[model samples]
Target chain A: MTKLIRLRFMFAIFCLFVSHNSQAQTKEFYLTLENHVFTPSELKIPANKKVKLIIFNKDKVAEEFDSFDLNREKVLFPKRKSTIFIGPLKPGNYEYFGEYYPNSARGVIIVEVNYVN
Target chain B: MLINTVILFIKDLLPIFVLLCLVSTCITPNRVPHEKLVYVCFSSVVGIFAKFYYLPMMGELFDGMGIEVIKTLELVLVYFCLLIGCSSLLTQNMIAAHQSNLTIVGLVIFTVINASEFIIFLDSYLANSQSIRDVVAGLSIGLGICLSFSALLYFSLHWFIKKEFFTLLYVVWALFLSGQISQVVNLLQQVDIIKSSGALWDSTKLVKDSSEYGHLLKTLFGYEAGPSLEFIMLYTASLLLFIVTFFIKSSKKQHYDIDRV
Candidate 1:
């Protein structure tokens, strides 16, 4: 019985690895944080498609890129680039902000069915 | 700024409070473990300070993925410790002597992980000479909310225990750990160690993940407004693993008792 349980546990882990390696290529988008504000405060991406977000924090201090709408969060060290993958999302607006500078560093990810590039 | 600080406080600190309440109410209800509490507090302070200082240096490693990698390691350690602790508790109907040490280790690791982010935030604000008053006020309000919620949750769990609702309590505890371990997927994906997928569903209209209640639920039960397929699979698997392990150990213990009789 213990052997059976161990085998099942291994199978589950194997499935996770398969899923991880089976992903197709995703589209890429860029956003920059400068003076505590996100550039292009609105970003557009295609609906129902996975995309990568490359965020650059240009300030001298760190910032955390937080988006409750997208269920993503990552810390962006100053002058360093960070990456986040989001969405095969429904067409709508998803808001994001800098956790450290929430009042000033805010942006929205606008997913559109007809958005190009 | 005050509101932001308050929100940040809740986001970073609520998990620690919830974990403390869960441990106290579920694991050791009758007597307060003052020594364990002191150890947790001391270790958390030391861990947070060490991380705050070394984090910037760590970020410079792994091509800037160092922090994520380190945080993932810390989380993984917490997960294993929890499993061992839970297994022991289930088999013995109490924490075995040495297993109590593992439980304390898990609590210390968890407290450190949850508190380090807030410490970093506070340090950054203080370094920039940001409004101390705002930070203080926000912290006070955040503390009050966390204490009140934790107190309510503690009493509720105690009531459940008195009512002999052990199954429900165990299920909730398992869910909490699974929810936490599932976060490892998100962290790994953030650092590109694991592939990220599209969310399985969206429930933002039902509960905005940014709202106060959303944060509360997220901390308490690992609630996500939108969860990816990977997240769901991992969550389910971990939850089942915990439940199965507990039951298996429980049955073996029962057999041993019968043999002794």
Candidate 2:
């Protein structure tokens, strides 16, 4: 009974540690597309970390989020939201655009390393 | 706005137009019947509507991988069909009929590709119908440019064929087709469907890909500023495939003729 209690105690501590690590590693950000244009146009994020991007498309037509630099592309439909996970990037400026409305829907992601303790 | 539309239209449409002209000229129509053209046209209309109807559903397929995979498959299939069709044109052999059928299939696939973009553009236009003047002007200018270009290209190829420069025509077709095949490789890499070792070189400083001349060269000759090792390999292989097939088919025809005599 004593041995079983010790194992259970270790398991509980390990689960807590894993959850804390995952919470620290992943970052979430939100963006909006309206009238075939990105709301912010430019987004800043911490470099070398995974990011979850939630995009809300409020337009009447679909638009593709294409970024050659980030090597990512996703189609966003009208009146819908999309979740894209992008990650572990080096510090740089990555440009993205809507394939259909290349002239209008453009945005940039600026990734920078965070030096704060 | 009109000028921008023209440029955009040219960038999207010129490559396909060039491909059609080169394929039509290279085929010589003797072995491949003209009746296939009507079938190809009919299939194009079907392809357009099918793509329009299915595009939204296409996005969610195969866990969001359906679109890229389907597009890549279509591109590769078209490339294969084009190769076989061009090969059959080298001689009126037994394979010519079957290969012509394959070419028709290729044309249908290309129609799907072409129509997808056009429908998307139309949808955008409809949504922004308030800018009707800009849309009409832009489309007209773009159409005019494409029409003039197609006319010039057709006549030029006709002149070359008239001069019996079949080999020159073959060379151009080989180069253009090779470039096109390489684009499939790039697309495959883009979607992470194919793995590449990254680009081998960078030439963007000398000639930006967005420049007019750059666009022309790309459309005419499949130029790339940064090509990966796999891309170069695929490009060279496809180019060799075109030339080898052409020569092999021509020699076989000569052998058959000599036997008959």
Candidate 3:
């Protein structure tokens, strides 16, 4: 009886944790382009919500968040900054990378709905 | 303001329209509108997703196809043009513009300057062992990406651009012309006549010859960035021949008006 009671408590606590995480607010994402590559190389954002993307390229070379998939091409010059206002969109995985380093300059923009939403 | 809107509409619709026409012949009557609509609509919508949501870097994978931020405008324009010509629905105006008039001069210029872009697309598509399944998979993926992008862009333009016709027409014209130029350049590369121009041409590399990348590019449209002297010469000659006719026609109108309206 005591073990059963303990198990119920743990299950309740786990549920609370998950519920809390799911309801958390979202914020705009920022990416830094240093050394000719995106800082995160991979990113995930909430689906169907506007996210502001601020890209800062600090390398001497020019970098761009370009993708045939995303249909977006924006250049980020050395130490330069740019903004991409996107999303509030359908759920999907989008990939982009720098034109310079096609192989290494790659990343994912995953748009997903929160479990609760 | 309205100009912008109309411009947006044509730019958005032209591709869908063209694609529909291309696939029309092969489609059964029952499936024609519905299937084509779905294909074009899907492709356009996917284009938007691919554009803003994903980033598949170019130049690194196979090269020349990378869309640098600085090159966005040109790339978009190129996409429009390529879609226009590749589609079977090109109107008489479109063909006329490509063949002889200045209506598509902008596209023609853009295509020539950005000829390397198509090469990249070809390279990526062919980035595997030559097999039907691989080819189909690559095409499917690419089409999905392109469709998503175009759809989102179209809707946004509809909401934002609103109602302009001439601008839309012009943009469409530009797209049509540019695509043909890419096709012409690509075709030149396909025929050995361009490649066999001689050893002087061998100095530069256009597509990734011998690499899976090159094979993909070659299959898409003969993308030889670093080519022998022959390819370059032929490419320039063919482009020039096309360009000259445009000017000759324009000049003829200006100088020899035989007392007619």
Candidate 4:
């Protein structure tokens, strides 16, 4: 009985930790991919802040959003949206591209020190 | 388009080839049956098809974090399978059957994960139908490069084994597995399943992580240009786990042999 109570307590604590870590509410940004191109080609996000990036692929074919600079990769399905969290980064230009259409689908995430949200 | 296809193929398929080379160096022919190869091929095909159809829907789960979660789980499983296989290799007492089974399972899972990404690219290209020639040429070139690399690595590892550089080989194996497992940190962080941290250091100027060299290093060593603290810790822990397990099992087997002698 005591052991069971202790197990339950631990489980509750674990759940609390997970929820707390995942719930910090970061600023969200949206990018749309159409005709194998990322719109705004240059997105400016606040420097040194972790932010949510929601990318929607409006094309009929799937595209992989790959960024060596950001250390991120995601397969954006056709007409579906995908979310990736990036940054808390130093101010710089991080280039990203669609893996399947790199020549045409390219963009850069500009992290600025003076960007207003 | 042709260059992009070549890069994509290398980025996605190189890891599978590297893994095959590593495992081949570790196992003897009699230890792994011929039938297991067939099973791995069948499983990979089925797994890729399943992932291709189901992954997009899975992405919708957990508030758009499903793919990350699934990949993380798959990576963790692959790590354990490698652990068991490594242990079996180090210890004489472990049953051969278990080792072969674990190897097949690990290969199947890793192949499915890597090959499915390539399949996605191929699917898109087929849909477009405009760049079929380029795609075919790129695939042929990629296949040649991958095969050449795998052959070179396999022979080099065998040379190391012949030279009795067991410790170096063991360390390389451990680092490779750890590096693969460390990817889970990025996946979890992407979905906010784990707390995100800033990169400990940046080496993008030295070696871009998307370049051909980067893909090769990442496949062989799990090289990350801007790994976070969490990634480092996980990597070190996994490396230690593999090393410790190998040594402990090795010592036990040595003791058993001495007793029998």
Best by TM-score: 4
- The DockQ figures for the candidates are 0.40, 0.11, 0.01, 0.55
Let me know the DockQ for model 2.
Answer: 0.11
- What lDDT does model 2 reach? 0.72
Better of 1 and 2 by DockQ: 1
How would you encode candidate 2's per-residue C-alpha lDDT over A4-81 as one tens digit per residue? 999999998645322123434557788899988897998888877766677888998877776655545666777877
Per-residue lDDT for B17-102 in model 1, tens only? 88787778777543335677687778878987887777778876886678777887887788777777656545436566556677
Greater-lDDT candidate between 1 and 3: 1
Tens-place lDDT per residue, model 1, A11-70, is 997675543542357677999999989998999999987777888889888888898777
Docking class of 3: incorrect
- Provide the TM-score of the second chain in candidate 1: 0.92
Q: Estimate how well candidate 1 is docked, as a DockQ score.
A: 0.40
Candidate 4 segments exceeding 4 Å error: A1-24, B92-95
In the predicted model 2, the residue pairs found to clash are none
Off by over 4 Å in 2: A1-31, A44-56, A66-75, A80-91, A99-104, A111-117, B28-31, B92-95
TM-scores, all models, native as reference: 0.87, 0.79, 0.33, 0.92
Best-matching candidate per lDDT: 4
1 or 4, which is superior by lDDT? 4
